[model samples]
Target: MFKTKWFSGGFSGGFSGKLSGKLSGKLSGKLSGKLSGAALAGLLTAAGAAQAASVSFVQPTDGATVSNPVHVVFALDGMKVAPAGTMMDGTGHHHLLVDGKPLAKGEVIPANDKSLHFGKGQTETDLTLPPGDHTLTLQFGDGAHRSYGPELSKTITVHVK
Candidate 1:
């Protein structure tokens, strides 16, 4: 016999060894294998077209001038911000796309100095940029870090003072 813990969905129970393999397969399929490659790309594209989710910067208004160490704030609608690796429907984390275009559908957002990943579900951060005009983008990604594309992103321009 084995014990199970379920969250985010209405699933709760304990089962014996006889059901382990079947349950494992089903859960694994749902979590990872259900959609992939081109199919996943198509699904992501369709979801973007169908849904009206959006992310926006709350602190620095577009075209505004600011000082160094800019404070960035993120706002989201039509979805919830969940930590990375949490595969719940209609939930995802944030990524900061600095002066960069959104990642293609089904493309994983890279974790680097330029492409910032807030896998911890952070809604705000402070960034130090060179004294000049720069564009900051708030991009949302799914549990697996797959980009939600431009449809779920917002970009703003700010000038450092």
Candidate 2:
């Protein structure tokens, strides 16, 4: 679970599925119209594709206890990492937040304890934090450091013990 000042509601939506060892199972007992397997597969594919891109932390999971000089990494899914020294659509850089407060959209994330910038496509870094529990977040942005969106950002809690 994650807590963020940027969002009001917590993450709640979820889906689960169970599959048994079966070569074939009866899917439809009675149907008026005929349905093709390809059509069903297409619908599922469309739904999956609509999930959209999101950014997350590749290291330092939630509630992690660590020492000083923390190495941080950011992970991107459904999007590509922008090349160093290149800025374009659907790509950019990563930002690190240490006990950070929310900044306005399109604000350039400063290279400080509160806001960190990785505009050169550098996804990992070492940080020094006071020994305590701190909220860490990875926010991806465009060329100008503008946030891609809240959905694209990942937040986690870590304890620097």
Candidate 3:
């Protein structure tokens, strides 16, 4: 990692890792999508924190209001989605933590209703929840279902009417 950075080191220090990741992801996303106006603004406004991987909501966007059986979508950047037990670098699966918090790195995401695992590499689902305010966390996990840490996750709020 250090040697690779030294070669493409745009800026120096630890900041380079974060800056490069963010800049690369942004540039690639922009060049591929070619978005403009509000759409570009929306992409810029999306909350992302992963240095090498990012998992976030694609549908029912953050702070969206909706009904039960919400149309949920998952988006990933800088990483590839694979089925559980694949055990490959830069690859993992998504997990929807409904009304749950982000798990620590290497921590096993519990098996329960709140923690919905997408071991088959699912990117979207129709989530049925009670009518009320809820917090949704999009988490990524390795083949063993161990979390990739908070940086690889995103949390959003939704109001069910």
Candidate 4:
């Protein structure tokens, strides 16, 4: 069982300073094997892609049904978030995918066209989606909007009504 909690506290000029992220839960030996299996699956999913920062939604579950103006939370592992021009290697911002294919590795993901980029290390946001089913994915990109790579993203499904 993997349990997690998210809270917001300090922000410098609308950019998140630190995230009070907490993870609790026990992974049985069997569960550990499962995690490794899942990791392998992800690697297989992106057979040939650039390295992108991995992200996950802390507020909503995949295929969750919710109202518009949804709150989305982003999480990144093995990277740091910085300004657009100050991004460092293995660190970057988050991009919200509305309904599109996964971005190619190293390809610069545009902030426009249903894509949302948080280059200032923003951790949360309220999004208003039109009533419909949408695929939500978090792609962490460098200062240049290039994907951290193919293995660092989290994809989920959400329905707005």
Candidate 5:
């Protein structure tokens, strides 16, 4: 079973830092795999994306076509960018979730081919992808690399030509 403390009318308060890894693990796995698109949208709407700090892509607008070595610029609002291990409130680093969806709240982002970590607090990068359509998710993580959840994330799709 999954445990969730959403941000609005349906959830509880005090999702402390201690609830991270465990809460995310339980919730993300179930939500990502089981919920239909409409169901997830409803939950997200109730979760209130506007209430949290958000991460976004400043370049490569959604549905735009571009060449390889795509330049990806990251933008964060309502927070500061700090290198990994800082462990400060309202501060974190940028992670580009290539060809993937936003991770669960407080989930420790995995290191893999698709998930690129900028522990150094970089705001931009040049990425190379094969010719095709790809979904890029801008995700924010705390100093410990635990995600700030879907409310803090932004997803955009682009095509590589």
Candidate 6:
């Protein structure tokens, strides 16, 4: 039987299994029922924090003026870029959040015109933006498209001429 003691907004017992490292408190017991949403969230957060990673723009220096069809390049450190659906530790693909804010932790990064997905492990891309000022955020997401949070993201501002 799996026993879990619920403390104030945390677990204070023991659970045996893969969740041992994800939880805040100690876990000791046989695997049991499904984990609650909170537990799953905690696990995801812990997983995201396991590595120290960073993403940045390699081209179009910040605050630079550019023309249409802007060329964008992405750089990553402390992790490997892998295609989506490839679940490997210290690996993930890049996402270009064009003029958008960072996605919440464990949140699924949306796919749209602004939110570009590099599921194929692309390191760079070309974007066409209207004449104006825009922000480009480079975010890295896990194989499942779950965001690694802002800690793994880089934002830059550019002016289109």
Q: Give TM-scores for every candidate, taking all chains together and pairing residue i with residue i.
A: 0.68, 0.63, 0.69, 0.65, 0.68, 0.68
Tens digits of per-residue lDDT, candidate 4, 1-161, equal 11122224222221122222221123332344666533533443344322333567887899899886688887664355666676444456777777766677898887675787776667777777778888888887778889765576788889888
Q: Between 2 and 6, whose lDDT is larger?
A: 6
- For each candidate, C-alpha RMSD in Å? 14.4, 10.7, 14.2, 12.3, 15.6, 15.3
**What TM value does model 1 have?**
0.68
Please give, for residues 50-161, the per-residue lDDT of candidate 2 as tens digits. Answer: 3366777767888788876776766776555663355655567777777775455676667654787665567677787777788887887777777776666778998887
lDDT of 4 at 58: 85
TM-score of 2: 0.63
Q: Rank candidates, lDDT, best first.
A: 5, 3, 6, 1, 4, 2
Q: What's the count of clashing pairs in each model shown?
A: 0, 0, 1, 8, 0, 4
Whole-model lDDT values for every prediction? 0.70, 0.61, 0.72, 0.63, 0.73, 0.71
- Candidate 5 has what TM-score? 0.68
Give stretches of model 6 more than 4 Å off. Answer: 1-51
Clashing pairs in 6: 14-27, 14-28, 15-27, 15-28
lDDT agreement of model 6 with the native: 0.71
> What does candidate 5's lDDT look like per residue over 26-145, in tens digits?
658877779854455445445553234567778989998998778887777656787789886667888888888988988999988788888877787778788889999988898999
lDDT of 3 by residue, 73-153 (tens): 777876667778989666788888888899999999886878888787777777777888899999999899999999999
Greater TM-score among 1 and 5 belongs to 5
Candidate 6 differs from the real structure by a C-alpha RMSD in angstroms, to one decimal, of 15.3
C-alpha lDDT (0 to 100) for residue 74 of candidate 6: 80
